[model samples]
Target: MEATQILDVARDGILTMVIIAAPVLLAGLTVGLIISLFQTLTQIQEMTLVFVPKIIIVYMAVLILLPFMIQQLVELTERLMDLAISLP
Candidate 1:
């Protein structure tokens, strides 16, 4: 493959990875931020308080988003296979 084709494939792969990861990451981030705010307001500084809620929320988000994530990954794999098959 040409350099541009290679770069394009790499870029797409990275973007797909980001897209797949974004929901879970964002859910964790948002849960953590909210938990931090609650802790600040309540003056509670328990380390497990932050971790458990974030983990649960992220896991729930992953479960809810699993189908979409799988679809995106499958599409990406198909596109990659097509490119590989067409490559010189």
Candidate 2:
């Protein structure tokens, strides 16, 4: 493939990665922020307190979003394979 074609593939790969990661990342971020705020207000300062909830919430988020994530990944893979087949 030409350099431009390679670059396009790379760009698409990055975008797919972002799209796939966005939900979990955003959920974790929001949960972390809320937990941080609670800690700041209550001044609990217990390390596991933050870790456990964040882990649970993230896991739950993953479970809830799993199907959608899988769909996007499958679609992206299909598109990528189509591109590969078309290349030669």
The C-alpha RMSD of each candidate to the native structure, in angstroms, is 0.9, 1.1
Candidate 2: regions farther than 4 A off: none
The residue-by-residue lDDT of candidate 2 on 1-88, one tens digit each, is: 8999889878888988898789888988998899889989999898777788789988998999899988888987898899889987
- Candidate 1 TM-score, true structure as reference: 0.94
Index of the highest-lDDT prediction: 1
- lDDT (Cα atoms) of all candidates against the true structure: 0.92, 0.87
Clashing pairs in 1: none
Model 1 lDDT, full chain set: 0.92
User: Which 10-residue window of candidate 2 scores lowest in summed lDDT?
Assistant: 46-55
